[model samples]
Target: MTAIAVGLVCLLVLGLGLVVHVFGRVFEGDTRPTLTNDIVVGTWRGADDCTFTFNADGTFVARNVPVSLFNPPGTTAPADVARGEWELTAAIEDPGGRLATVQLGFETVGEQGQVGIHFSTRLRSNTVDGEPVLYWFNGDPDLNRRFILEKD
Candidate 1:
């Protein structure tokens, strides 16, 4: 009975250690980018030719984005201009608050007065090839569905 109890405790400890290691690695290499209001409040272009303009008033405009980029087939994918709201959740203007990421919500208004939030994404800042980029996973397991953007 004593040996069995000790073995169970060892297994439990090993499992907990593994969990801690995985959790620590989650944000390990993130190297959160330095974010500032001036640097972020501008127009950004995605690889798919979509443009996102972040205004100073916490408003945003999304243009030239295709619905098919996100929605699967057999769905109502309307390619249209979207209006949305955005904000810097981490650092208002401080570069030290580099850990900050942006959250945006977009809405689509139909012709018959139907308004709905059709898309939402969280963008994290990173540097690629000596240039800044914003990226997010589009909820696809294929990895290629990841959306990336660069300053326009």
Candidate 2:
């Protein structure tokens, strides 16, 4: 009768709404920052002391940097400024049985630039150090200092 038909319609509508709600949550899940987005991106200067922009769009550009100034006060200048492009190479999880890490692939248009391009780093969990970071130099420096990654 009419009552039976009405009950079925109500149930169908409610079921459809529930399905939609669940699907929405699933789609939002992939956008989550796999614990690496917590890492910050910032500007950096190295041996040449050039000013550059480390964009979130995976492209970078630099203008003024003293090639010779990167040397120690007593050391002589290299006679060339350094500049380059950088991109996220890889992101790895720490084997502490916990998820962590992300390495970037870096290339350059000038002479002598390395994978030490990305900086302004942070962690998903506060269980790590945030200052004067210590990690692998990664095909960049024989003996390098912490390149200041100034967040724009």
Candidate 3:
């Protein structure tokens, strides 16, 4: 009887341990990659054929990018090439962790002459087929009209 009681207690403890492990995984939040300098220092392309090249020296150049992306909503204009400075800062607090905010400031030389523009968005990260991917949303997320730029 003593041996049986000990075995039962052992089983109970193992079962509790298994339950905790499963619950921990269930609440582990998302698998989004953490924003870092090394992860963001690269080229990213958008669906609109806009390419953003980020250099290690905290500078960036964007080509074939729509002017509306940097302007207010409903401002339709042609694409423009620009060069500027970029920075990342901690922003959103997620269940997984805090995400970074990306800020871009550039000057576009068009028929209207050189115009300075500044844009800010949250830096989002994800994985595709075991590869880390980074992106930023260009429009209102709730409306589902999002312009996404994916890392190259």
TM-score leader: 3
Lowest lDDT block of 10, candidate 1? 90-99
Q: Worst ten-residue run, lDDT, model 2?
A: 119-128
TM-score of each: 0.60, 0.30, 0.62
For candidate 1, give the lDDT of residue 53.
85
Which candidate model has the greater lDDT, 2 or 3?
3
For residue 147, give model 2's deviation from the true position in Å: 4.3
- lDDT for model 3 comes to 0.67
lDDT for model 2 comes to 0.41
How far is 79's C-alpha from truth in model 2 (Å)? 9.8
Mind giving the per-residue lDDT tens digits that candidate 3 earns over 11-41?
9999999999999996674566556778788
lDDT value, residue 27 of candidate 2: 65
**Once model 3 is optimally superposed onto the true structure by TM-score, how far is the C-alpha of residue 137 displaced, in angstroms?**
3.2
lDDT of 1: 0.70
lDDT of each: 0.70, 0.41, 0.67
Clashes of 1: 0
